[model samples]
Target: MTTEEQTAVHAAMVAAGADRRPGGRTRTFHALLEGWGVEVAGVEEGYAWCGPEFDNDISCRSTLADVWPLLPPRVRSARQPRLDELDERFRAATIEWPGRGDEEQWWMWRIPRLLVIEPGDPYEGGWPAGWTMMPFPKPDSVRVIT
Candidate 1:
């Protein structure tokens, strides 16, 4: 994340009293952010995002949902509604498709899904070879995927 973004996240966490909370709660919040592809560090200086640029991915929906109730009312009121709106749009653009045979279902979003292939992976021979493209479902409203 950019220094500005890291500062912003750190400020938000501090404003939410993350540093004052029990260690477990702070750790849980840190883990959630990390799972969202954010690099978290500086626990003693208060939590900060030290990762690559923040993409504000759909994964943030779960993070917000899980942490909403734990935040101070002021923080929740300041941020949750806007995040909820964005999450709704993301959900509308996403489809949960059942997997073939015994595999579990997975979510497919309207945007292109990035697949990170390791050097020895079977699909590493060519880019886009391993991808399964799907047509987006017809939206009932103009707001979907807008």
Candidate 2:
């Protein structure tokens, strides 16, 4: 990973509230990535750790898919099996969500339903229609409602 990418990863980790001291979340995630033959210092591993922490389960999968093209062929080959296993597990655990309207189908982990709201909608107060909002960081484009 380039210095900029590594810095981004670290920043993401901090933004996600990961403990970065010894025996912290960063170390644990790096250890798991290392076992998958990913370089512990690489952007791939850093992103693999930060994505899920900073966002959600599907975000992790999507982030890895986004980064896959940047990996070398040999690294891709080495990581494919593990990634496939994770994909299978995620698929097995996921269920289709129909709450986000008919035009957009979202598949999420088999937990309580979550709502994702885009920006520019008017808001007044007290849980839009009584759905409790989760305390997630809202980016400029979207807010995750859990």
* lDDT (C-alpha, whole model) for all candidates: 0.37, 0.38
The TM-score obtained by model 1 is: 0.32
Residue 24, model 2, lDDT: 58
Summarize candidate 2's per-residue lDDT along 18-124 as a digit string, tens digits: 42534553532233333333321122222222223323434444445444555445556776788776544433433223243232213232222223334443344
Candidate 2 runs further than 4 Å off: 1-58, 99-146
lDDT of candidate 1? 0.37
Residue pairs with clashing backbones, model 2: none
Query: Lowest lDDT 10-mer window, candidate 2?
Result: 40-49
TM-score of each: 0.32, 0.35
